[model samples]
Target: MPETTPRGLAGLAFGGDYNPEQWPERVWDEDVRLMREAGVTMVSVGIFSWALLEPAPGTYDFGWLDRNLDLLHANGVRVDLGTPTVVPPAWFYRAHPEALPVAADGVRLEFGSRGAICHSNADYRAAAANITTRLAERYADHPALAMWHVHNEYGVPVSACYCDSCAAHFRRWLAREYGTVEAVNEAWGTAFWGQRYSCLEEINPPRRAATVGNPAQALDYRRFADATMRENFTAERDILHRLSPGVPVTTNFMTALSQCDSVDYWAWGRETDLVTNDHYLITDGRRTHVNLAMAADLTRSVAGGAPWLLLEHSTSGVNWQPRNPAKTPGQMARNSLAHVARGSEGAMFFQWRQSRRGAEKFHSAMVPHGGTDTRVWREVTELGAAVEALAPVGGTRTEADVAVLWDWQSWWAQNLDWRPSEDHDARERADAYYEALYDHHLTVDFAHPEADLSDHPLVVVPALYLMTEAAGRNLREYVENGGTLVVSYFSGIVDEHDAVHEGPHPGALRDVLGLTVEEFSPLLPGERVRLSGPGGAGLDADVWTEFVVPRGAETVWTYADGPAAGRPAVTRHRLGRGTAWYVSTRPGAEGLAALLGQAVEDAGITPRADLPRDVEVVRRTGESGTFLFVINHTAADTEVPLDTPGTELLTGERAAGRLAVPAGAVRVVRLGG
Candidate 1:
């Protein structure tokens, strides 16, 4: 066996995607030398090299890869060998044109882009399996092999296909899931649309419809597409597990709220040997670091609080966004260490060298086109040394002070057509709630609706439109057991099948919230409402409002003016031993912070009020000791309170009482025993 060690690293795993094929053979020596200089321990190789690996059908070219792996191993760098199954070669596509994905409007997407394969096609599956098997067989015992990267970022670029092959595959999946055509019709609620199918053969993928398609049907197709992608992933993973016995297998996940929303990460989290995610900042004028922290926390939660890897991030700006502004000096290191503080084993970037020619030539890399003199190179080398200094913090887990409920399926349901208002975006609500908690300097762990909530002192349901009975019961039980809960509007209104819960609005949570929503009152564009209460004074809300009737709850805030003026806009209910707060309208940022502040007090959790704004503090504990990461995002120097004296990892200085962190810097302290 090559290596059974965790990610083939004794301490921290650090590096980027290494594409040796992109450069000349003479450059390989220099690349490895630079890698060693930067303290790179691992590099993901051959992720998009299918065309080069199998130039012609069934003709393999392992000479180049063999030499590359050998060279990496010689330099003491481990390899995350990829299966090369993401992008098929041109010859394979010419042979199987039907493998291309078709859009919802019946347009077949042409080749030339990555992730173009129709996952449901047999020919594509056979080709993928063959490539995966070939790579596994050849590198099973290679000394450089540490982990098997099955495919590069599944569900990106293309997820769902509307081709005929996918339609047939969808029918089979439905048959297995529903057992009968009648059951499918019932679950999909096809009776109202006059679209009930008598046989499974008559059904098809939710294709172009005259009007908006059935919400339930669209929802199921999302599930089916996600499962199909997983099927391909698991097939590749199984081949690697059998051929390469001790190596762990994983496919990178894009779990950020603004990124791929098709895959249910909770399910995918259970399938991988190790959970890894790729996060990029979407700089749209909002706080990018907050989104980074949220993505890192969500990824760690998906890993079941175990140490996960930051598989791929840009060293600076990304090319795909509308604006590709380069990061400021020292921002790269701060962004990287933030992830490490949230439970990432280490930080890795997109590519080792900035591409000279490609669709992503402008994308940032560790070694820019300016070579070793650029600011990016300086920060990259500095980050590498920083990672090495924090090796003692490896394997430690960050403890979360609160939990946020996140479900991709619920997000999918809310994003469908003909909703009350397009302004009611699920992703926006999630980001808002996470930002509120982050401003309070609270560490958050995202949980599935049905996951255990007993451990978290506080839980926030941002916006869950599709809630099953089990999840509702779970929340009720959690609150009854003394856990503080905060639920937002539009939650628990529908069941798993998109059917409205029978009786009152918010069907599943009416009892738990101690209030009933008689009707949804959505505001027109540019309209707003004022809220009045001790915590809600001068608060303005918009996008949505509800006519709430308090039953066994006390009114915390009332709509001072709007369509639902004087109605209970926010209510509080006391359950068995805990408290539940409900917000019936979207409040302004200050209002949200105030409401959450009350919930934190109710949970008996203290906020770090002494710390300045934008400074982040997180703790990671393990058998070695406790490590405190204080990241200063502000412009002025600030002092952070420390309970125990410890050695600062970065400067090798002994810190006691309180530590002064300079502006735009990160400090990791290894607490004394």
Candidate 2:
């Protein structure tokens, strides 16, 4: 679990969410002792320390915090100071009547529930800003300070937040985005049921339990909410940065969370600096790696294809789940290493110590079993020692030749479509393609839709259902500039307005893909069809079936033995100096692996061949030297042939192709060759 990470703050950041408030003053002594026991140098404090920070709006207390900071400073540990705006005192809520949020169901949220406030609420926003500025002014020169934590889980419980202020702002947001109420109504197809709005206030967000009848409106609402959250995040971030620019600022994002608040990268990434996200892989499973990799990639993408922190991973079982299954022995480290192998720059456990009582009292921790001499502590110590010895692995970076195209606009546009299908959800399909690439030992840079593609030679976008005219044109330019591209089925069916293109299914892409999808034949599970390569026997297509009428492209793969058999399942068309492959069906990972290998070869992308698929290699460049990280994820020990010679980062280790890496072992090698 090693890769080249970001410079400056990039070494093995050994710390996590910390709260000195929960323990007795005497217990803080043991905490310091344990910090040296493990290489724990950083602790994020004040995340939930709001109750202890200020007893009331007018009165504040830092007596406990001063001692906590003094302890960390004396111990030489850095602190990621958090602004306790998440859960303030009951006095603040009682006094600031506008602080509470009105849910979509029109009920003002009671205090106690986290994330139950409208960010647009003037009083709430001002209060949060006030808290951040005060904290910054107080801790600006604090030696224990390493970074600033804006707020704890900014987007949790984001499904609600339909306050009067939010509604008023939502109208303004819609006016700016859609230009006019009539345009908004038309895009939403308000005429379908006479839901047209004559004025902004006439429009109402659906209830907390409301059904998404109009996808266009629903999509816009989702976009507006995301934007609003970003605005709030930026407000807090600016306050912190102004107070202390040297302290890198960040807020933990939740993983691929359904709530739109965690959805948009372009909007919130600017303030986040280095993106960190919370992800809990509920149990030990093969799919866990894929999920963690996706989170790491998302974090990296926000950092502009750089490294990110695995901010919050449970040490064992968490408190809030349908079933709280504890992680098996070695599972926690295994999972954290998976994040490292995939591309997480730094790793930290969720809660340093278990909460003694309350909602998350049972959540796992680094010292769950006891104070210093327990299995969990031993495991943490072993991991820390391994990390310290593996110090050379620090600053190892991951570089990708190919990047998957991801766009919030596409995310918005697809959901805005009238035919936004529950059966063919595009987001899940795209995630599958990305994870497939990861499994193939291909380091893929997860990219925003409009992000620069000039650095990448091959771009894969699966099921991109929503295309604005500008985006389609940009894709054309990318292909014409000699970039190999892959566009899957159900793509380009609708424009930004959710209107069907006149000429064909893929309106602008028909020129690039050289084909048209007449209508999709939704094939269910266990559906059988053979997709063969010219006269090839036993070609496979198990999931989807489609009839392809090629306009100008050559058929590379075809389905067999079905009503749609003998039609093109995979087709390629030459556009400009490059080629475009359109996958008509969702193929298995094996099939996609084969397709990508051939496509990368066709695109002249260097694969670092003669290496095993289970073995991963990434090269990160620095001003002085370049670092190459090799990871072995396979069960059996394997030897990797390296072109590098005498490039040693470890003791008595030689850079040779025959270097043996045990199962789950990672090596940092320099590529002098």
Across residues 493-515, which tens digit of lDDT does each residue of candidate 1 receive?
99999999999988999888998
Q: Compared with the true structure, what per-residue lDDT tens digits does model 2 show for residues 332-425?
A: 6666765664556557877787778778888888777466666777878776664555455454556776888776656666654345234566
Off by over 4 Å in 2: 1-10, 96-98, 208-212, 255-262, 282-284, 321-334, 337-344, 389-396, 412-421, 561-563, 606-613, 646-652
Give per-model TM-scores.
0.99, 0.91
Q: Candidate 2, 592: how far from true, in Å?
A: 2.5
Total clashing pairs for each candidate? 0, 9
Q: Distance (Å) between predicted and true CA of 527, model 2?
A: 3.3
- Candidate 1, residue 35: how far the Cα is off, in Å: 0.7
How much lDDT does each candidate structure score?
Answer: 0.92, 0.72
Which predicted model would earn the best lDDT? 1
Question: After superposing candidate 1, which stretches have Cα over 4 Å from the reference?
Answer: 1-7
Clashing pairs in 2: 3-396, 4-396, 4-397, 5-396, 406-449, 530-560, 640-657, 641-657, 642-657
